[model samples]
Target: MRRVHKALWWASWCWPGCDNQAMLVEKNVPLQSFNSFGILAKALSMLRVRSDADVDALLSNPSLKAVPKFVLGGGSNIVLTGDVKALVLKVEIMGKQLVGETAKAWIVEAGAGENWHELVRWTLESGYPGLENLALIPGTVGATPVQNIGAYGVELQDRFDSLDAIDLVSGQHFTLSAAQCAFGYRDSVFKHQSIDGEGGKPGFGLAGRALITRVRFSLPKNFKPILGYADIEKKMAQSGWNAAAGAPSAMQIFEWICEIRQAKLPDPKVIGNAGSFFKNPTVSLEQCADIIQREPKIVHYPLVDGTVKLAAGWLIDACGWKGKSIGKAGVYERQALVLVNRGDRANPVTGGEVMTLAKAIQTSVYERFGIMLEPEPVVV
Candidate 1:
């Protein structure tokens, strides 16, 4: 195993066949600190990819070419069931810059490994206010498009420009437009497995085969803060700002979102959690009406498309899971949608325990509401 110092990286990349040109492959890397859950796990082999060139070099290496790989980002949205057997490609790619601008929008691009919330802040601080509504999301920029992440009245697809990714199998660098990504609620092409088409043509899905390198967001020139959610409205009322008189600034909305989230969700640093444990289940109007008839106080939001999105937290709370524990995993007291690690770092909750609690919650919610809650985190 060849190891090159950080200072020598540029020199090694510049000079081919250098003794230190081999990609750094760390062995038996502990992953407790890597994942938000703080579950104990180890990656047998790991590589920190700083750039697409590093990915190309990794693929060209005969020893690593055939090994299965996991592209890890902030590790905030995953649960480790056990030690990872595949080679973990930890994305450390870092950069954020104003790429370009059009008449209506300012285009900003950030490296995949750049922190998601930091990017939102940087964009706002840089005089781009479109991303302020998505403040405090925990993950990498790469994971944003993959998950179609959204908050308050804005979704990533609303501001997405395009993204750069590397095809893991062909080692081909490609760019995807928003349409090509096929973004949906908490899903994109990246979340599904590739389908085999006739004549060996790729059908749909890029899961496990594409590594996102950079994400580009289009911030509108005429920025309007997204304040449709009840939480934001409550914040406005508390602040004595009348919506009819004037709207809050993007910065104010950002701060309000930060405060709202802080009050409701536990900090992952203090309490191990993967943010919202489940996706808010969407149902048709008739179905929602039926459920509403049984449970008159069910919290739901009607979408423009006539579908109703129910609050998963309310369902869980109604099922008596809030602040409840199963083994080392527990539902967050403030927000029942969030599952937390009730154990300390030295005795952290296992992935099995988290899933067990989640399953129990799902069963309870389903029995009560007739809606099965889907988990948001990817279980590894």
Candidate 2:
């Protein structure tokens, strides 16, 4: 095996190409520090794969086949409850490309393991404008499609073109177009389906599914930049962005998004968190209208499918869960959507505190607005 670089560690595993006598920490060890949410969990056997060959090598391990296996990105959008019984594979490779760029537009490919917001700033610094509004989004490039991650009125599918993914089953590579990804509001095929086949073998039915190593974006050229979000448009108008529209670079939008995010969400570094805890629940337009008739100030976003996306944060705040504390866990005071770890307590914290608050928010929102808030991270 070639020398591989990985910042995280996982549990030990015996594999074909690896020397059984000498074990590399990067290849297999418990990883409690890599995740932002700070769950101390040991991967039963882990492998941080920098290359496709390393991924294949793990697949070839018969010991890993019968036990569980999981593909992990930056571990930003996950809450690990216990030591993962599965072999957790953390992706750590990085790269970027100006695949195509016009005077006013550009397309780029970002490595799956690259920080999402850092990539956005990179695009902005290089004068590529579209990604600024998405700055500071948590997680890696690979997981973007998993949630079709969106915020402040923009989504990954909006600028997405195509990408390649290895089929964990066939051990072959395939490309997926934006449409083929079956992206929806905060959803994609990967979210509903698992790489491990429940109906078949270990990696069966995993077509365009595996570890996503690279993501290609088809960003706009000569397009009207969106002052799309109401609050953002208001801020931009105040900043004289309307006076010199094209002059407001991606960095401007990046700063705006960062300010908005900082104002709401707690810094994950200071307080362990996985960004937004719940996804905005989508209800039928009529249902939203009914809620609005009762409250008269219900907020919603009109979707193309004619559904109304209700703000999950507003619902949680209205239910009085904001700043509610339980042991070492508490909801963020400023943003009802974020759950924070209180850091100072000796309380035996199970990552389940995130789930408990999520349930409260979910139940509260459902009772108040008839909308069930779906959590963004997989709780296990």
Candidate 3:
């Protein structure tokens, strides 16, 4: 392959008479450090995309056009089972700017590869306050919309403006509004597989098809703190704040959230983990009442739609999974929702062990509560 630049270049697999423009590519890349779970794996071939030009060039390359590709973001929400055979596109695109402001909202955009927590901090420091409730979230800005990431009482869709993405198959550029993206509880259209010939058109899912390039958030100009979560309310009480008192500043809420998250969740850097291992299972009120009759102390919350959301952590804890280890994988002691790698770098937890533990937890929870817990991380 002809060299383009020192930093980025085309892969040796380029077809004859291919364009000379260099695209960054690496072979047999180690990926233990890439995923939050610290699972050992390798990518047969990897490409680093720094701009739209890179993606365009990649899609146009004859040799790579037919090869299967995986769009990777922050690597915080995936589990690597083994070596990746598909070409891995590691998005390193980076930029953030205030796009515009309207009468009701401030529009700010960030590249898909930007660190999510850092983006939250940047917005707060730059005088944007609406994202404070999501502070300290791990992963990339691109992954946020895919997961419909939320914490405390604020979700990404609640502050979403729109997003720009490139279709991997058709190489078409498009923008999707919040409604078009179809955000759900810790889920989105991007997480599901599209059905064929459904509804006399294409199906609803976008998983593995679209590459998010940039995301814009509509932070409201009239921001009010979201303090309905129990932890935040406890903090408010401890700080001597009452209903008649003024609302807490965004910075204060941000600090409190950071403190609360740190105390409950294990840092991926220190202890290999994927944050919450499972999504809290939701059930109908009648089903919840039945479960509650058998287990009166079961923790649950009533949703706006009359569904009852049960704490997966509580069920796991009640099953004696807390602080329990299976091989090198274990459930976190402080928070049962998080599965962790008990081994260090020399002998980290294997993806198989992690999945095994996860299945066991699911079986127990289902048997006890009649609720099947779904894993949050993508299993590759």
lDDT of model 3 at residue 352? 95
Across residues 1-380, which tens digit of lDDT does each residue of candidate 3 receive?
Answer: 86554433446544334465445688788888889999989898898878887788788878787888899998999988898999899988899999999999999999999999999999999998899999988899999999999989899999999999998888899999999999999989898777665565667788988999999999988988889888999888888889788888898899999989999999999999999989988999999999889999999999999999888889999999999999999999999999999998988999999999999999998887777899999999
Taking the tens digit of each residue's C-alpha lDDT, what string does model 2 give over 202-250? 5312323467888988777654556678878777777777765565655
Superposed by TM-score, candidate 1 places the C-alpha of residue 159 at a distance from the truth, in angstroms, of 0.8
Ten residues in a row with the worst lDDT in model 3?
A: 7-16
Model 2: residue 103 alpha-carbon error in angstroms:
9.9
Q: What TM-score do all the candidates reach, one by one?
A: 0.94, 0.86, 0.93
- Which candidate would rank higher by lDDT, 2 or 3? 3
List candidate 2 segments past 4 Å from native: 1-30, 101-105, 194-209, 237-247, 344-348
TM-score of 2: 0.86
Query: Model 2 shows how many backbone clashes?
Result: 4
